[model samples]
Target: MTWQLRRAHEADLEAIMHLETITFVHDAWSPTMMARDLGDPACFYLVAFPPDEPSAVEGYAGLLAPRGAVEGDIQTIAVAESARGRGLGRTLMQALINEARKRGARLIFLEVRADNPGAQRLYERLGFIEVGVRRGYYQPDNVDAIVMRLDIPELESMLVETS
Candidate 1:
């Protein structure tokens, strides 16, 4: 249940890619692709590592934003299957969202597979609202993607209460 958050680096690309492939079924990014995203100037990557396992990152979250934009999108979030249900996902999200706010992001957005009720519930509980849907968003499986948005204008207050 204990972990630390830090900016992701090239060394974490393999772990990130592995987690993505395990958690997501479509649009999965390869290690090279994840590396590119992590290196992009507009993207923010955060990793969570257990207190005793500093050499291995247990979870990661990514956020992307254009310059001067008040809104940003969560590119991806994944926790190792063995690490699920321990609130690591939520913790990673909170860390990423707080970092986004520190960088001037006022809103946060993400798309999740419509079938992922667990993730949807988590996001909703954290203040995200269903905004729209992308039909046939996931290839192969062809599942819909529910678009969710969180207005972060009062994020500081909520974060304080949640913390």
Candidate 2:
């Protein structure tokens, strides 16, 4: 399947929240918070979808990196289960990493569920290393979160792409 990536907009909130709630079943962000973040200028969010159905948001990712900021945070990333393993997650992450560079972030931080080895492996492949752990970070579920950090190099060629 040919998927395209694009900056997420207000119109995509319904679709994004749909995937968000399903993908992060135990700890999905409230729609209100997501809407606020989507409108925030400091946040860069992207959605992936088949070109034929623009409203079908198969996956979504977000980053908080202000211009000239020293650090960035990968706020969230979720891909529909059906859309996994075709490199969509990595593609979303690559775009966010590139956006972090463009916004002048020296490093990026993210947290993964300790139980999620697949996500941990992906972050590792992207050069993120575990730095710490947030015990019981995922509420109710009480799952520990593995904090990871990635020091981004000063590379101008970290190009942003939509294809």
Candidate 3:
């Protein structure tokens, strides 16, 4: 289950879109929206693929870290169902966090569906704490969103000790 992560490119749009449709169904971003995000200079996107099959995208994630900003956001993250439980989500999260740290972000934030406790637990393990809740934030599905934040310095300290 060795996978390599690299910056996402336009050529990955199809695979990423497919994964997004399956992963977020009712909440999936349109291809056009995804394209705009991909083109934004303030955002960073990465896609994961198996080394032996470069065209097979297993997952993708994006981060928004505007230049000189102290805060960043996890725009999106998803792993193909087949890729779950292999730590791909963790890997994508760590990559986003590391990128935020590199960009001098003091805090990182994200909103996860309230119903997704698994994702919440993963964020917790990565040092994010619930900061707020947005009721009915995810439309159609009418799902609440849990806002979470992580203090970059605190996360760095935790990582330091663990390493």
Looking at candidate 2, the ten consecutive residues that score lowest on lDDT are: 153-162
The lDDT of model 2 is 0.94
Which residue pairs in candidate 1 collide? none
Better of 1 and 2 by lDDT: 2
> Candidate 1: deviation at residue 158, Å?
3.3
Error of 2 at 21 (Å): 0.8
lDDT by residue for model 1 (39-152), tens: 998999998898777668789999997667899999989888888899999998888777778778889999999988999999998889999999999887899999999887
Return the TM-score for candidate 2, rounded to 2 decimals: 0.94
Q: In terms of lDDT, which candidate is strongest?
A: 2
Per-model TM-score versus the true fold: 0.90, 0.94, 0.94
Identify the runs in model 2 with alpha carbons over 4 angstroms from their true place.
156-163
Candidate 3 global CA lDDT score: 0.93
Task: Evaluate residue 98 in candidate 2 and report its C-alpha lDDT on the 0 to 100 scale.
Answer: 89
Ranking according to lDDT, highest score first: 2, 3, 1
Q: Using TM-score as the measure, what is the rank order of every candidate, best first?
A: 3, 2, 1
